[model samples]
Target: MTSNDATRQALIVRGGWDGHQPVETTDSMIPFLERNGFAVRVEESTAIYADADYLATVDLILQVNTMSTIEKDEFAGLQAAVLNGTGMAGWHGGIADSYRNNADYLHMIGGQFAHHAGKDPAERTGEQSDNYIPYTVHISELGKTHPITQGIDDFDLVTEQYWVLSDEYNDVLATTTQSVRPWDAWNRPVTAPAIWTRQWGKGRIFVSAPGHRLEIIENPNVRTIIERGLLWAAR
Candidate 1:
């Protein structure tokens, strides 16, 4: 692609649960791309199928969708585009909790938010028992050496601590351990994968489970990790 081609391109898709704050989350990233010379385009719907070739011209794909079902053809177009070298990156439920019925989507993303086994339960009872319960995220062994995590340290946040079921194929960047409560638990302590990167064909995929809201993304460390991850994933 020529400079003109690159200058004319950017693709951003945002939809799904309102709680995840897709609109606010993706809007926050628009200026970043614009500053980097991308002509950012934001889509409020997931109708990426209407222009299947749009991904072909895009320099990067920023998805802020969560827990939404995608049609086969639409997802196939995205899968092919990413595999063919269109960059893919997203954080939290937007990426990890997206397209639950599509195994291919999950495969490309490398993991899914399985359960939160620490303080919050699957079923909330009290006012303070929501999934948005706060906790600190520890930067584990692998984070020290990864480009996306370079200079980043252990950070604290008041967001959902993702308990992800990740494929061993991923290059895990960070992790947080959650201790199981014996009274309500089924197993021993399990370590959760917090951030990861993986390759799909000639393209790249990045997942970060921190941005539950715009405020969560505002954290300097979280923002830095996401900013680096987006660039790293893009071609």
Candidate 2:
């Protein structure tokens, strides 16, 4: 199709840590994108990021990769694509915790996953569930007016609540606080961005720090925000 085609193109690059259920999570959104007029493309690797010619044709990129590495050239191509107006969106560790060693990627994302503070030591079972905790996502006043989160009331969730290191460049839409517990090292409670967006060059980037699993992605509020975010960020 030509660049002027009415059908927008979305590229989904998913696959990394199975703990995040990347495949299932990204697959769940395929129908949503299709129904909204996106011609979707799914790939299991970041190798496609190196294909500048193809990336140029993409209107949006939905990445669900976690803790994986991207080669220098691959990242360069992806960076160039976004700089030229291709939107990028993703959630949780897939976008926040990816490419631990790549500072340039983190800079582009405007945030990085510091860690997920686990539950009370008493509840620890040496399993992934140990990181699950009850928390609230507080929407910012600006978020109330933003298209992606408007009308969405604050909500609670029992899951991996992320503690993120973000920059001033991000427009934080929602945040979650990590409280000070007797077993915790931090002296006081700290709030971190749970949902945010950034404008880079001619492109837009959106991130919601929720979707760790399919069920979480399917949450009505989370789903709505993500769907709107995808559309909002699309070129």
Best by TM-score: 2
TM-score of each: 0.89, 0.97
TM-score (C-alpha) between model 2 and the true structure: 0.97
The lDDT of model 1 is 0.81
RMSD of each: 3.2, 2.2
**Clashes in model 1: which pairs?**
none
- Give per-residue CA lDDT, model 1, range 87-149, as digits (tens): 888999899998898998888889899875435354566542365555667776777878899
Clashing pairs in 2: none
lDDT over C-alpha atoms for residue 190 of model 1:
72
